[model samples]
Target: MDFKNEKQGAFMVVVPAGRMDAVTAPEFEQECERLIQSGELKMVADMSALEYISSAGLRSILATAKKLKGQQGEIRFCGLEGMVEEVFSISGFSSMFPVFDTRDDAIKD
Candidate 1:
């Protein structure tokens, strides 16, 4: 996965492209950690560019959420489509966190 980040108001918008699987899951975690350490407590994950995701990716996201929770931080999602959206919905991730249509909508909260 190729991850990119942009700061928008109080949130960091995370864009992950390509595929997210076991090999790249750690990279995602590391990036989230780095963001957290940098004092970014609010995040919006824009998954529109992501073509694929696996259980490892889900685990990484869960782990990231835990990290943010302890610091009173939060993670939300936007631009989810195709199988990625299905996975989130089937796995009940949709209810676990806020899912928006765009970064702007997500950061509004």
Candidate 2:
């Protein structure tokens, strides 16, 4: 996955393209960790270009969300489509986390 990091108001946006599977999940997780360490807990993952996500990817997101929750912040997902959105919904993550139609929507939250 190729990630483009951006700062929007109180949130840090990570726009990752391509597939976020086992191989790339760790890198994405590290990015989240970096944001957290930098005291940027409000995260918005702009997954508009992400084509796929496996169990490892879901785990990484869950871990990040948990971390943010502890810091009194959040991790919102946006621009999900196709199988990626399906997987998240089927896996019950839709209720576990907040999802938006655009990065701007997430940022506004």
Candidate 3:
């Protein structure tokens, strides 16, 4: 996966692209760790460019969410499309966190 980060006011908008399987999931987690450590706790995950995901990706997301919760931080998701969106919905992630149609919508709330 590829992570593109941008600063938008008080939040960091992260655009994750490509497949997020076992091999790339750790990279995703690592990136989130770096951002969190840098004090960018409020993050917006823009997944529109992402093509695929696996169970390992879900695990990575869970781990990140847990870590953020401990730090009183939060991660919101936006731009979900295709199979990635379906997986998140089926996996109950849609209800677990905030989901928005765009980065602006996420940051607005």
Candidate 4:
């Protein structure tokens, strides 16, 4: 997976592309850790370009979310579709996290 991070007001927008599996989950978690350590609390994960996600990927995201929550931070996800969306739904992550249909919507709050 490839992550592109951008600053938008008080939120950090993270755009991840490609497959997020065991091979890439650690990198994704590390990136989230870096953001938190750097004082980036509010984040929006724009998954529009993401093609696939595995259980490891979900675990990484859950870990990040828990860490962020402990710091009173938040993570929102947007633009999920296809197998990626299915994974989130089947994993119950769709209800666990804030999901939006668009990046713009995710950042609106």
lDDT score, candidate 3: 0.92
Instruction: Give all TM-scores, in the order shown.
Output: 0.97, 0.95, 0.97, 0.96
Steric clash pairs (candidate 1): none
lDDT of each candidate versus the true structure: 0.93, 0.90, 0.92, 0.92
| lDDT digits (tens) for residues 23-107 of candidate 4 | 9989889999999999999999988888989999999999999999999999999999999999999889999999999888888
- Residue-level lDDT of model 3, residues 31-89, one tens digit each, is 99999999998988899989999999999999999999999999999999989999999
Backbone clashes in candidate 4 total 0
Per-residue lDDT of candidate 2, residues 19-107 (tens digit): 88999999889889988999998889988889999999999898888888999988899998999999999999988888998888898
Cα miss at 91, model 4 (Å)? 1.2
Better-scoring candidate (lDDT), 1 or 3: 1
TM-score of 4: 0.96
- Residue 25, candidate 1: Cα error in Å is 0.7
User: Of models 1 and 4, which has the larger TM-score?
Assistant: 1
Q: Flag regions of model 2 displaced more than 4 Å.
A: none
